[model samples]
Target: MLENPAPPPRTSPATLDPSAAGAGVPCRAHPERTRIGNRPARRRRAARIGVPTDSPELNWLRQSLRACDLLASVHSISPSDRALVAFAIEWAPYGGADTEDLFIKFGAQRNRFLHLLQAAMIPRPSDLGHLRNLKTTLCNDLLRAWNDTPPHNEKQCRRL
Candidate 1:
């Protein structure tokens, strides 16, 4: 015999049925083990070497790809009429991942180049003026950095 018999646990109001309350009918007891009460733990794995998992810059690029009207317009056109159709028809021997993924892998400089390319490609009526200005400024800054790089001579390379 137990020293004291514990009272049964009270069911929450959420588990009670109002119709059965005054009808003298017993409701099924809520289960002792509840899946609803158990929350799965969140886990984040580390990125492998040279792999970018996610970052604000990557997120910004992804968002811009989703929002760009010029990209959407290009995708809606016939494949043969696409802006890069000439390159694909004549030079692309092997298929590969998209420009967005490539930009993510290459980092900011490639991202800026893509922005400049896209801004230049947007239809004249579309409002990409701000983006064009931004990319132009960025490209100018990038060119300034390249201005410091020593020029490579073809004769010097042939000697090596």
Candidate 2:
């Protein structure tokens, strides 16, 4: 057999540098101005007041008051009335213990203050065993009255 013809000369591909190949073209990317691989630092917020960390009932009431739409109604009432209602929210499940003080502070007779509280939609738990339930119902009523939402049927409420 005839010897194989001499191998053809090998041709090597040339590599091009990106910077040299695109010298006249401008890049629109502004990588330095935007965040990359690093998250923005979170600002710390102040702690909320009026609820003990250990008490679930107080915590729920505080959260409900913040989220409820009845806030407008609270603002529409007189300032003293508003203060009493706020105090009641903080003293829920135990408003009876503070009745005398509530009376003095509001500068109203017991019956008058009671009527005011009822009218203001202030909540008070009627039974020790169902304190949480009562608070939840109060929150639900507030939500329904102004927000048109149903009561929370969460497991925490059922546990009460």
Candidate 3:
């Protein structure tokens, strides 16, 4: 007989004993295997291709986004929204990303992308002032450009 017997291996869902699994609750033997740990893994996978953040001038926002350890903001935001945030950060120094760029990158026209970006930022925590300021500035610039451009037959955005 083995001095220390190993735990029985789980063969199938039907054979899983509830009592063995901590009485129908999750087996907390390994904290890393819990929901909290699993959710971050999903986020990491979703954003595995982190934002491409190279630009002429290095800014705090860009540096934060490009950090080796992913930021909490990155974890909290959705993948699509992360794209918008990245686009905003990259273009902030140059006023903003234009409608054609937005459409090309996001597949949405200026007005539509503006609305989408606004919605995306709502759920984000406001404590991150840098992010909030970046978004606000970008949104303002986009709105201004949207208003300045003539409604019909608009080709290029009017820059102030």
Give the best candidate by lDDT. 3
TM-score of 3: 0.38
In candidate 2, list every pair of residues with a backbone clash: none
RMSD in Å for model 1:
19.6
lDDT of 1 at 53: 40
In angstroms, the error of model 3 at 111 is 2.3
Tens-digit per-residue lDDT, 31-119, candidate 2: 33332221121111112443344466646655645433244343433555556555555555443324467566776665565455555
User: What's the distance in Å from true for residue 73, model 1?
Assistant: 4.0
Give the per-residue lDDT digits (tens) of candidate 1, residues 21-113.
Answer: 557544356333253232122112224344354665444433433333333354532333233322221222223234664456433343354
C-alpha lDDT (0 to 100) for residue 15 of candidate 3? 52
lDDT, residue 145, candidate 1: 31
Clashes of each: 0, 0, 0
Model 3 CA lDDT for position 119: 64
TM-scores, each model vs. reference: 0.22, 0.36, 0.38
Q: Mind giving the per-residue lDDT tens digits that candidate 3 earns over 1-160?
A: 6575887776976457655555556556755676335645555664677733343344454353453123334554567777775676566556567878987899987667767755654434633655555444444444444455423422112121
